[model samples]
Target: MTCMRCGREADPPPRHRIGFPAPVKERILQSICAECWKEWEGVEVKVINEYRLSFLDPQHREMLQKACFDFLKLPEQA
Candidate 1:
């Protein structure tokens, strides 16, 4: 499928967590390509450190999620 972020035709993640939250999973399956997602992984770490985020905190996780999604150019869920 063509990736919404990269406009490349590539395979999706093999084990995408379908059970993940609706917005998260939908973006993965519908808009984000695997390569872009991997790139987002590194950026996500930087964001976490730059913001001094604790993964255990729900607010922190939410912030990270939005950042990662935005960096991947995954349009906001409607």
Candidate 2:
């Protein structure tokens, strides 16, 4: 599979989580490749720390999800 962001050829992605709201999941399964995803993990960590986010909060989760979309350059949901 080719990475949509960097255009690098890579192996097929592993299975993802069960529930991510369809558009968010599609952004992950389609545009962001594994390598980029790994990098995004690090970025996510930083954002989580800097923003002092807690995963238990739905608002925080949404914030992180939006950050992921921005980092991946995926278009925001309409």
**Best-fitting candidate, scored by lDDT:** 2
Per-residue lDDT tens digits of candidate 2, residues 1-78?
Answer: 777677888743444631357767765787667788878887887998999999888999899888887887777774
Model 1 agreement with the true structure over 22-49: per-residue lDDT tens digits: 6677658777677877787678779978
Model 2 stretches astray by more than 4 angstroms: 16-23
Which candidate should be chosen as best, given TM-score against the real structure? Answer: 1
What C-alpha lDDT does candidate 1 achieve relative to the native structure?
A: 0.73
Tell me each candidate's TM-score.
0.80, 0.79
Question: TM-score for model 2?
Answer: 0.79
